[model samples]
Target: MKVFGFAGYSGSGKTTLIERLIPLLRARGLRVSLIKHTHHGFDIDKPGKDSFRFREAGATEVLLAGGQRWALMHELRDEPEPTLDDQLARLAAVDLVLVEGFRTTPIPKIEIHRPAAGHPLLHDKFPNIVAIASDTPLDVQLPQLDLNDPGQIAMFILKSVDLA
Candidate 1:
């Protein structure tokens, strides 16, 4: 399966763009999987939840299973985050894998850019960027897109990955 990514600094609309793109990608009948990267200490578990308790109790991993849904939380215990290949191996086969972070990797990516956020364009430094979804045009040879246009942006993503 092919992999595409959204990469940008914090609050550059990366998450928002992916949120809009998922439905459009799914509507095209393509199976999609997502990998979102988070920095620092973030928890999906509640303080008193069993998973939370398990981690606190020195269990390195916790898996909660249910009829309709299941979640597995693994505590690294100071271990490093898994590499991209490691993460990819865990995903089921699909038409595309849309990753939300992992900026320095070699995977092709579309950058979600909000000029007002005042962050430098990642394309300037990262050659992996295939396109830039932005609120304003930049004086670059790369393809430009309006960040508010999810339909168009999603289409660009699909095309960039040759999914179209």
Candidate 2:
């Protein structure tokens, strides 16, 4: 599967761009899987729920299922956080994997940049960034795409990854 990423500082519209692109990509008959990274601690299970109780009770992993859906939660009580590749291995095969973070990884990425966010462009520092999607035009040598145009952005991604 081809792996592409959207990397940027907080509030740079990475999630918004990805959200828009997913549908556009799917329209072209591509199955996409997304992996989003967050700095804050998060939980999918609520307090007092059986899954939550089982996890709190020292179950390393819990598989919760219903007729139509199932979710697997694994707790890393003492183990190191799994790497991106490890998490990717858990995903079923798809045409593309759109990663929302993990800026340091070597995978090719599009840097989502909002000039209003007042953050420096990541492409200036990361060689793995193959393109920049921004509200304002950038003077960089790499391709600069209009951030508001998800259709164009999706087309660019498909072309960049040679999946078109």
Candidate 3:
């Protein structure tokens, strides 16, 4: 699958942009998947649920299935965190994969920037940033995209990965 990523400091609207882009890409008849990496600990299971109980009881993996969807939760426990490639292997094939927050991964990415966020641009430090999506224009060498324009951003992403 063609993989693209978005990198930016928190509050720069990365999630919102991705959320907007998904439908646009899908409307173009391409299948898309997403991988989002977070530094904070998170749980999709709720307390008192069977899946939660299973996990609390030391089950290494717990899968829950319903008519609409299924989710597999694998506890790393003492194991080292899986690499990006390792995680990617678990997904079913798709035309595109939009990754978020794997800033160090060597994938093509767009750096989302909001001047109000007061954070320095990341493309200088992170390699393979093909463009920048910002709320305001900046004096950068990379192609700058309007953060509020999802359709334009979607077109750029497709073109960057040659999906267009």
Candidate 4:
């Protein structure tokens, strides 16, 4: 699958941009998949759910399947953290994969930035950033898009990945 990525420091608006970009990408007839990296642990299953209990009872992996949907939860208790490539391999199939983190990964990316976030730009350190989406313009030398203008941002992403 063709892959594009978004990276930035905390509060840099990566999630907001991706959330809007997904629908725009779908509108263009591409099957898009998302891989979001989280800094801390998170759980989509309820604490008291049967699957949760099973996992707590020493299940290494759990698959909860139903007529309409299914969920697969794997326990990585002592395993090394999964890298971007590792996670990407899990996707079944898609025309494009949009990643929300892994700024250090080799993937070409769009860096979302907010000056108010008081964080340095990731592109400055990682030249793989092919473009930028920001709340305001910067003096840097890169294609820039208004952060809130999801349409144009989507356009840039689509073109960057050769989808447009």
* Candidate No. with top TM-score: 3
Q: How many steric overlaps are in each model, in order? A: 0, 0, 0, 0
Cα error of candidate 3 at position 85, Å: 0.5
At residue 123, give the lDDT of candidate 2.
89
- Each prediction's whole-model lDDT (CA): 0.87, 0.93, 0.94, 0.88
Worst 10 residues of 1 by lDDT: 154-163
Higher-scoring candidate on TM-score, 3 or 4? 3
TM-score of model 3 relative to the true fold? Answer: 0.98
Give the winner by lDDT: 1 or 3: 3
- Tens-digit per-residue lDDT, 69-111, candidate 3: 9999999999998878998999999999999989999999999
Regions more than 4 Å wrong, model 2: none
| Local accuracy of candidate 4 as per-residue lDDT tens digits, 33-148 | 99998888998889899999999999999999999988889999999999988898999899999998888889999988898888887788998998888887898899888998
TM-score of 2: 0.97
The model with the greater TM-score, 1 or 3, is 3
> What tens digits encode model 2's per-residue C-alpha lDDT throughout 1-164?
89999899998999999999999999999999999988889999999999999999999999998999899999989899888899899999999999998988889999998888888878878889999999999888999999999999999999989998
TM-score of each: 0.93, 0.97, 0.98, 0.94
Q: In candidate 4, which residue ranges exceed 4 Å CA deviation?
A: none
